[model samples]
Target: MKEYLDLCQRIINEGKWIKNKRTGVRCLTIINAEFEYNVRDNQFPIITTRKGFYKSAIAELLGYLRGYDNAAQFREIGCNTWNDNANKNQDWLNNPYRKDKDDMGRIYGIQGRSWQRPNGSKFDQLKKIINNLKRGIDDRAEIITFFNPGEIEMGCLRPCMHTHTFSLLGETLYLTSYQRSCDVPLGLNFNQIHCFVLLMLMARFTNYIPGKAYHKIVNAHIYENQLPLLCNIQLKRKPFQSPSLIINPKIKKLEDIETWVSVDDFIIQGYRHHGAIKYPFTI
Candidate 1:
């Protein structure tokens, strides 16, 4: 992870800074990593020195995954990342195009229940992939997509913009995600780490031994305002530790079974370190 931080710093010193929708101005670039074979029990991709914007990130992710477009629920839970858009004068409250009329009408429910590809398919891709895994179908063809090109045009934040492919090889599954841009300090770094954790949980829910998730960040750029923070992150050193697993003995719905695979189980090695260092950012 130090290597990643160093590279990000070097890019900041030489890269261009530009304004982004999510975090003002940022330093952006393209990053590529090639792997010879599958790597197992690898270091989790999360940064340990600082809290990687977990609370808001998790709320936003759950809202998208569950298909809840409203920020009311998240705001009540101390999450306000989506409030900016949800509070706008776009009539999101009564938009007729909203597929789900109620809170249950979320992307997860729609995708898990009413999703169909353009070719007249009647199955939810995500659920189908999970069922296939339950039946022990280990192949590269088990990929599920969350990006809907049609929806992207209709004012929806592009779904699963980062994650592109998921493949199961034996008990371990490998994931490939593409990000056209990243806020290395504020958003992208944390998003990748959380998404990796989510994927691991999904793998365990389907009774597969959770292994390493290969995160491919294309066009990986850091925000200029966050360069100072990245430098401080690089200076920090900590040993990684294997994550511990937590399982719920009682299960009700399939969703509950899925939730039983706790995110806490997917631990980043050696993140426990000294107090937070001050890394101020100047745009």
Candidate 2:
């Protein structure tokens, strides 16, 4: 989408270079920035500048909604994105809180679907949102937050796309996704897809039409190793028209998503883009 291309170009032109301590890599970083996607026009925000893996993106999102806390579960769902962080991260492997093999601890879907309370009770954030939406309630608190302060030490990595707030206006649904940190080259590609598709799915089960998706980024950066690729290769390409997402009409309820949805159930039409650019990913 143009918005993605613009954000990338803005980072290239305006970002400041800094040495990131976590990955020991240089980053072209920028401060607060935002973008929006119009779901009402059926705009699927997969990056057209380079080959975007819609299936992996969708799978990751689905795995989160299913409350998966294991990397094996994500792999079963056709997403190996968590493999590196879950199994290969030496820091997490050595941490005392790290559980058995392939455990991601309490992060993302684990926190979103079953957040733990001080009383040792579990709170289902996703279920609550769906239930409230079903009752046509727009109480300005339809939020699903994956950032758990208490469990940060237990997880392999903190959530970048941490919170999502859904708003209802009449019969239309809109979403605003918040991110604390963003790896512009690698993470943002999948993130845009996640935000737009998330709104689409939420609207589907809640009896509302998808309206728009907004992404708010607090710290957006392109890794120094990835700058050459984004500037010389990926960013040089032209973006095609935004594609349309096709979800299974058979998905009639929220529970159906947990047991019935797969990558095959989602399709994207008219997606034409440049070949894949293997930008360097840091854990």
Candidate 3:
């Protein structure tokens, strides 16, 4: 978890100010940051400095895995993380592609689950990856990507953590995720857990041992309003040890994950941390 703290300090120490019109706030921004999680040891990359929302983060990932494109669906699964972006973002609210209330247009899950094809058919990237990995086959291209530049204008928001690539070496599974932009103070906490759990779940269903989850960030930034709390309070506190994650073995297939998986199926062990530090989310 010291790596997480180091990132925060790095932003405070070395970041440059950049004006962002979307949130109407300046940001301390940097580029090309990286983090690697030791999934084989179950050393979960949860933020131990604050009361982390591991369940909610898992639930959000589940919604994407289920191909849910609506915020309401996420809420029904005990994840309210999308409510703000769905209904509150003025740009999305004004976009004509927005179907109705709670419509997330064709963002993360939609792109991952049913990436549109050029010939009028649909492609299931996740299904293909799962099936291939299950058979101990990694064609060196087991990728599920949600970065559709053609449909970017139609989605609620452009995909940030856009691509997830899986690799297999013998019986071990490894994952690498790439993101173009990040709201470090708020989003990174959840994303680390998301990637770690994604690798764990993929390993479980594919009969592969979890290896590691690598995360790459292109532009990492803390909004001006978020910098004070992150740099002054959260960074000042010491981080506890990384926690361990356990997932139910019942999730043996992609269908199992899409059909009946709940956040309750995942549990955290030995998660000791300081009190919660509430940070304002940038829309």
Candidate 4:
């Protein structure tokens, strides 16, 4: 947790000022920021300075596993993160490929679960990885990526936390998550949990002990509207020890994850934090 706070402080001290034309909000930005979580210790890496929403983050990951491309599907499973991007994004609304309200298009889980193939057959990137991991196989290509250049224009928003590569060494499972862009105040909190939980789940299903989660961010920034709240309040707060998460033991396979898994199935223990400090989010 100190690393996260340090990253924030680094942005305040060393970040460059940049104007974002898309959101029309200026940002204090840093590049090539990275952090690691020792998942082997079972410590959940979350923003201890604020009351982070655990269910919402977990639900978003679960939705991605199920290949959900609709914002309504995200909401039904305790995640509303996609609502604004799906409904309010002007470009997505104007796109002909957008199916209806709450449609997120060909992004995230859609691409992970059913990537378009050359032969017209869909490729299940996640399934292949899971199957390989279960059999103690590491092909050195266990990756499920959400960033698809071919389908970027068909989606509501470009993926921030884009690629997750799983690796197996003996009986330990490690994760490397790559993010192209990071909204430090709001997005990093969710993304930290995403990376930790993802590694934990993959380890659980593959019968391997969870190891470390390494998160790499290309562009980390704090929006102009979010600066005061982050600097004046959040950055000033003290962070508690990282918490721990417990998953349903019965969920031992990818089928359980694909068929029916909710945020209710997961629990976080010993989460201590100050009151929630709402941060600004850009569409």
Please list the C-alpha lDDT of all candidates, in the order they appear: 0.50, 0.91, 0.90, 0.91
lDDT of 3 at 87: 97
TM-score of each: 0.68, 0.98, 0.98, 0.98
Candidate 4 achieves a global lDDT of: 0.91
CA shift at 276, candidate 4, in angstroms? 0.5
lDDT of 3 by residue, 1-283 (tens): 8778888888888999999888888999998899999999999888887889899999999999989999999999989988988999999999999999999989899999999999878899998998998877899999999999999989888889999999999989999999999888888988898899999888888888999899999999999998778767888888788889888877787888878889899999999988888888888
lDDT of 4 by residue, 221-282 (tens): 99989999988888888889888888988888888988877788999999999899878778
Q: What is the C-alpha RMSD of each candidate to the true structure, in Å?
A: 5.3, 0.9, 0.9, 0.9
lDDT of 2 by residue, 1-283 (tens): 6777788889989999999887888889999989899988988888888888999999999999999999999999899899989988888999998888899999999999999999999999999999999899989999999999878998999999999999999999999999999998898978988999899989988999999999999999999888888889987788888889998899878787799789999999998888998987797
> Candidate 1 residues 176-248, lDDT tens each?
6555444455555455555564565466557676555555554556655555555655445552442332333
Give the Å shift of residue 94 in candidate 3.
1.4
* lDDT score, candidate 3: 0.90
**Which of the two candidates, 2 or 3, achieves a greater lDDT against the reference?**
2
Candidate 1's C-alpha runs over 4 A off are 18-26, 31-44, 53-56, 76-78, 88-123, 232-254, 257-283
Q: Which ten residues in a row have the lowest lDDT in candidate 1?
A: 33-42
Q: C-alpha displacement of 183 in model 2, angstroms? A: 0.8
* Candidate 2, poorest ten consecutive residues by summed lDDT: 1-10
The TM-score of candidate 4 is: 0.98
